[model samples]
Target: MSWGTLRNSGQERELFKRRSFVAIIAIILLTGVLVGRFYYLQIIEHETYATISDRNRLQVQPVPPTRGLIHDRNGVLLAENRPVFSLTVIPEQVSDMDALIEEIRGIVQVRPEDVESFQRRLGERRRPFEPVPLRYHLSESEMARLAVNRHSLPGVETEARLVRYYPYGRLTAHVLGYVGRINEQDASRIDQVAYAGTHYIGKTGLERVYEEELHGEVGYQNVETNARGRVMRVLEREDPTPGRDLTLSLDIRLQQVAHEALGDRRGAIVAINPETGGLLAQVSTPGFDTNKFVTGIDHENYSELRDSLDKPLFNRATRGQYPPGSTIKPMMALAGLASDTVTQSDVVHDPGYYKLPNSSQVFRNWKRGGHGDTTLYDAIVLSSDTYFYKMAYEMGGAEMADYLEHFGFGSVTSLDVSDERAGILPGPQWKRRVHGEPWYPGDSVNMGIGQGYFLSTPMQLAATTSVIANRGARRPPRHLRYIDGDIPARHLLPDVVRPPVEMGEKSDWEYVINAMEDVVHGSNGTARGISPGLNYRMAGKTGTSQVFSLEGEEYDEDEVAERMRDHALFVAFAPADDPEIVVSVLVENGGSGSATAAPVARQVMDAWINGFPEVLTNQAIPGAMENNGPSGRDPQ
Candidate 1:
């Protein structure tokens, strides 16, 4: 230590000075580089970073308008909106979406679909703080549980919004239809931008047909969101346009009466106002509660409705295809008169069966011993198979079909409902196209009896009956009575117009109508049983369409399985001369039109005509249809 201190004192002083100078220079250069980098970041890229920051707070959202209300003619709400709560989540507020959803599941019922839908929406969202729906239609109890746990969850909120509600759910299901969640098929067909805020779309019936009017224009707004992704305020908004209110021609009371009249049977009843061409009631039973469809029907409940033998999902009033049976005879008789194939005075011998010129095959009548030698009036009143068979053979299928088309057969009517069936009105051309066979004389004979290839829906039958009620004048079988408030909704279809059935003889309208009246009023008429208690004149036809051919065997009602039995049908109009209402009834597998179907029609008709008995007290009317037994009898 003593040697080192004496030898290196000067050398050490110079070396230390040199090292200190080098260190000071190095420190100065490093500080200059740091200052330059800081200036570049803080000043040059300031606006770019500011835009990115703002994007995380601001979002554009759709402002959905209120859905339109639907009402019957009497202002009874058929479809209306009611407040419902849905659980929504702000994505930015939750540290982890999955963890929060899992936590919320413990508080309220969280379906797997809700989670799946939320995940999909989260990825699609452009804004950082917008709320996404997690669960829809929260029950009161579920809402209470979620409220109790609100303190634990930061981003979850219960949002109140109006949802579609059907008060008379099962009563109006078929005609009014119901709204449902938008699905893939719906998304493909609808305008995506317009539907951005909406979840439901019309699925069937008038709701589908008038979708554009019912789904109003979509509006937009810019929103400011907080760091938690909660909407702090709406920055700017364009007002949303609400859908137009629609008014229907349906009478709620008549709808209830007809629905009750069907009563556990698999059937349909369609009633129309002949003067206004508006549907009073359209019923298909057994009906399901329409409210179930508004949000989303569970798979199990939908399965029960779809697989049920009763087929409540099937809109039988407009979609059921059956042999028109004797229900079509009035139209046929009019066709024969116009074509001169048969006349009112013409007579035919009914020996219980009809046979073609050289054919051994026999077409048996519903009556084993038919009315021997019947006129056109008696033919319709007694429902003679031989009389119509003779007329069909002479007029031929093509000519008969041409006339029937004028009465709205071989096509769907203008019922303002979607998916209505246009029942088959077959002829030689149709048979050749469909079955690859030419028409036969037997085919014409079957057609005469409203069987074979001939088919008609209850909707079509109601319109046809109304044509007779109007004395050959025509009108659409429509349900919409008004749009908004006073707009008329009839006399035209999308691309079709039904012309009046002009007769070669003007008096022929009365001629066929008289025969129809005899069916209900005549002593030996097929539907005479309903005549006794009638306060006002009624014209009706009873029909029994064979589900399977008799093939020369006598029909034993007791021997047949209930479903294998014939379809009982009836078509009627009340206060015959000044006709107001036209009703068509079809009882699937019901035994006799007179017994099973006519009574149902009578109850429906009486509901309209004999409504407010206190005011109609001067007029003696049967207070209830129970006064009349299941009435009418026919086939052949």
Candidate 2:
């Protein structure tokens, strides 16, 4: 017993010692590995890990400051920041997201758009602790309801935000385009680092042109948050630098006046300060509500706006292309006089029609009986197509194209807003290049009268008129006056210089200006209707552009559809002696300038002349004359 028991005890003690040795070695190896890993992390990646940890612990969320305000030439606010309340959610603090959404839905109507937007953001894999906005611009009732039910809903909150508002709504929609949500397309175009927390971006018009000035630099706030993502105390904050204010060349009163003058017409009116080329009023009729595009327009509303018959979304002032019709007669007349093709006194006997050199197809006059024995002055005043046809025969298309191109025909005006069409300046080269056809005399005849392939935007027409008013000094048409306190006095850019628009002699311009004045004021003038009550002498040309080609048969206004009727057009500069403003108006399917467009232009000119007092408030008339009142009616 003593021998076996003693051996067993010794073996048991040996086995125990072996196990302890192995255990000690294992512990030592594990401890060495842990120490090496800790050293690697602490020494090599210390800065990165420290930064990441700090960021996670004290996340500095962006607090977007108020954007810059926009005012007219007068200090009346056009665009401003309005206080808006929104609902938000913190996913990390929420246990049941579906239930929370449902709960919010019961309290305040949560739209599919809200759910879809949140889901899209979640898919971006943003941090769960950060709060994401769900609904914006919440009503007071909705906010109160959410606040009342906050005890039952965790991780849900309401926040106050500054939203963009257009006080005039559809009145200034085209000129002051609305801001929209940042999308994939915008992200690709924008610098992600620069726009760290920006949600809305300018999509078009002045908003897009002055984005840098309008979007303020982002600011950060450091607030201590609890384990459940509730803010405990504010540590520090970097106050945001608010965006700088902008003052546009636009006259809000005039803009409102012009908008009303259009009166449901589908067209564009561009008015510019001929002295400085500052755009005073840019009105596009059938304009959509800019507020809808801002924040976010719903699918149905967006579709309706997009698919409407009137095409309210289209910016006709800058983007629309139309044949200038007789409105181009003044430019043609100037071209003829400047080119020495025709003299002011040179007489052309127009017997209702003008036959090109060899061709028998006669280009007929609007007045089928024709303006007999018409000179350049008489031709311009009457808008004689027959006289221009003969001039086209003498000058040819290439020479005429060269002359017209000087007045911004078939060219962009380099406007502040994007998307300007250089209307068709069809020459021998352009016709050959694009249409794969040779230039002909008939083409020249059509181009001479602003027909055939020649097309121009209302902005271009206004710009061209400004050149005439300024006596060949072509100023750049500018919409934005200043950006971030920097004044844009003249837009005559250094890199781009339009070859001096020389009309051969100053007298040539004078003759054309005289004829244009006659067209507005003369007894036989087509636009005489506008002159009956005008206090200031305005020089203008009336035009009627046929939407549909007249196939030899005379147009019966009664038989034709309203859409198929001729578009009335007028280009004018006020106070002929010292012209300040140049305006171009196009009334879609309005038939004649004298009947439809001239009246609208008259209202615009009246506003500009009278210094745009509050609309319809005629308390006292300072310079009210008896014979010349607004639209020939006595000033009320």
Candidate 3:
């Protein structure tokens, strides 16, 4: 610059102009690039950025559907729904689940079981932002306290929802069962998407059997939530469909009478419609409140019930298996007639006991001096053990099994409920399979009296009696009568196609029924005590099953404990000409069927006939029931 700076102002001006032009061109290029970038970002990618921003404040919430309702045949609501407040929280919004739960515990009452149940659900597989219930069945004060501190607690919500309720909890506990909250084990068994917002599912009885119809479809809603995950408002909503309601064949009046009949006794009663096979009444005494199971039952109450000696949770009608005792006498009579093992003219002179072909063991009768020269009709009327003992042995185990199978023994009847025990029907094969022993002649002799390994449930007895009333036609016992929209196929199926009991002579049905009629109508019948007020003809059989062995000694009720005594049982059907209702009763540790179970059955049948006059013109007979049975139980 020093060499060329000798008086060159004109050249220096030209250089300055060139430098300014270069700087202006560079500025223009930089401005073009900045504009292009702004256009791409604001116009081309507009929807993408907007969606990303909305994701912070928008959410899709699940709407759980309402559960179904259950009703008796008379339209009496058995199971329903009640509105309640529950506290729920989203783990994604919650910074610390444990800390938030602790804060909730401080604000309101939080039971240890609730916390424990919540923890179990938290570990289950779940989607993001899905609210988990912290506490259910919250009180008004608890909800108010939670609301006061809700602002500080993000991701927490107080939701109002409907929960299951049972109107007659104790009366229908075993029949309808209950629902409980979804837990980890339940989550594993269910479809998470289908049960998104639903927290309850059926656990037992008809509830479990009809779960698909009882739980409806879930819906969804697009909602705008705040920074704390509190829902501001719903933008788009889809309504959830409610579950289908159920109408059962059970009669509430009959159920009440049966329950009352079993008052304070740990027993069961099952009544059936002989024509339609509808379960008119199913009662199990010492029942617990089913509502307690709807929500989480407290640990203390649950433990108390679980440890109780009476087994209130047990369904005696469907599950309690006891020997049929003399209740099977009429059925055995039918078997004898059908198998040609014995004829109506055949007679056996009983000397109070019978001995097997070569065995020395003497099987005695209930009467020390048995009915002399007993015919088939007299055997059923007098409940002569010696005659049945001879018949059972002659019929043989194979023939017995085949005939009894047609009567719904050795298998679960087509009852809709899932929990049912297939009462034991013992034979040579069954004995070998279960006891690892061969069937003996003594076994057959004992079975003649409905003892020794021949076990049956009160439900089975009721169904079998229905078969008898139908005169060899079989109708499988069922509970469902109607549904909200479409009824299940099982309700009116299978039974219709099943073949009627093929008999040597169908008129024998009338013959056996008449013999049973004399048991209640004849002067010297075993159940004549309940026959005084019979407006219409009735047929019945009385039975007593030994709880323990007597070892050839006389049974003294005074020496036996109440629980260790014999179980009294009865099977009967009204209007022997055209039976409408068939009832089977079991009295735990009751002294005699004639004294205990017969009276109970009379009350139930009277209630059915008197309550529904259209069914029959029946009036309640004053002093129709009597307890003047002998001091000794029906040891037969």
Clashes of each: 2, 0, 0
lDDT of 3 at 180: 91
In model 3, the clashing pairs are: none
Q: What is the per-residue lDDT of model 1 for residues 281-359, given as tens digits with 9 covering 90 to 100?
A: 8999999999988866766788999999889999998989999999999989989988888888899999988888888
Q: Candidate 2 lDDT, tens digit per residue, 486-524?
A: 555344223233544567688888888999999889998
Each prediction's whole-model lDDT (CA): 0.83, 0.81, 0.83
The lDDT of model 1 is 0.83
- Runs of candidate 2 with Cα error greater than 4 angstroms are 1-53, 90-97, 117-131, 148-155, 484-499, 613-636
Cα displacement (angstroms), candidate 2, residue 260, comes to 0.9
Could you give the C-alpha RMSD of every candidate to the true structure, in order shown?
5.9, 5.7, 6.6
- Compose the digit string of candidate 3's lDDT tens values, residues 14-119: 9999999999999999999999888888899888888977887888778999988887665667889999898988888878888888998899888899888778
Question: Could you tell me which 10 consecutive residues in candidate 3 have the lowest summed lDDT?
Answer: 627-636
Candidate 3: segments with Cα more than 4 A from true spot: 1-44, 485-497, 612-636
How many residue pairs of model 3 clash at the backbone?
A: 0
